[model samples]
Target: MEQPVHHFSELFEQLGLASDAEAIEAFIQRHAPLPESVALHEASFWSPSQAELLRNALEDDADWAEVVDHLDASLRKP
Candidate 1:
């Protein structure tokens, strides 16, 4: 079964980020609400492997998809 995402911090951990409360909040402050024109995979903040993980999760609709998608949207500029 797929795990429900409980917090942005969890998403950060899955994405290989720091995942601590301060780190997660800092990351969000820095990167959340990405511009509409910027594709998630093309974000400058991600390493190639990290981008690949997100791309694969989204393409496969795997267990990570929900959280990945949440991150994708969160990173977009409103």
Candidate 2:
């Protein structure tokens, strides 16, 4: 079985964000509970490049998609 190469820290790095565990957790906490009406890529907090990366990852189902989905879930209401 193949292990996924993408992870939350790496995703943050790709987004040009702080990639440490504490930073990631804080970021998630800060922006969490995102409304069901919003798509992850459409979130206003991201920069243009970050949004584009997220959009492409999901739209193309790129290698980053799995972790991207994880992040999206983390930010939204359970």
Candidate 3:
């Protein structure tokens, strides 16, 4: 079975970011579309811990993997 869809709030919380609506909107406006050349883990916007979380999620294909992958694709330019 497919996993339930994960919300951006969950992602923000996992990254230790503010998950309030205002914060989420501001974060999206500021960083939603990261450059094509910038890997998710390399984005300066993330804290070191957040970056490490992303890296580990991607590498390990853990429960967070699907959301992390969605984030990776969403952030990058097509």
Candidate 4:
């Protein structure tokens, strides 16, 4: 079975996403595995507001820079 995701918000926080619409969406898309289209049909089943926020992030480039910086730091771990 797929690993249990206790809370979707955890996904955002783990990715260091800002609590903005675009960032949430990007987080979802980035983490969601292939063959699963990132759509509210699946996402909406959870929380509409959160899902919408994620969708908006997917559409906008709002949090790209910060996320990248965070990623660079994470990658340097020994």
Best by lDDT: 2
Global lDDT of each candidate: 0.77, 0.92, 0.82, 0.44
The TM-score values for the models, in the order shown, are 0.77, 0.91, 0.77, 0.31
lDDT, residue 28, model 2 = 92
Worst 10 residues of 1 by lDDT: 2-11
> Sorted on TM-score, highest at the top, how do the candidates line up?
2, 1, 3, 4
Error of 3 at 41 (Å): 0.9
For candidate 2, lDDT tens digit of each residue in 1-78? Answer: 764688789999999999999999899999998999999998999999999999999999788999999999999954
Candidate 2 runs further than 4 Å off:
1-4
Stretches of candidate 1 off by over 4 Å are: 1-7
Better of 3 and 4 by lDDT: 3
Candidate 3 TM-score over all chains jointly? 0.77
Kindly list the per-residue Cα lDDT of model 3 for residues 20-74, writing each as its tens digit.
8888767767787888778899999888999999999889877788888877776
Tell me the tens digit of each residue's lDDT in model 1 across 1-78. 746545667767767889998886678679877888878878898999888888888899767787777777766744
lDDT of 4 by residue, 1-78 (tens): 543423434445644446466775664455443233434323433466545554554457334434433432332333
Ranking, lDDT, top scorer first: 2, 3, 1, 4
lDDT accuracy of residue 2 in candidate 2: 66
Clashes of 1: 5
Best by TM-score: 2
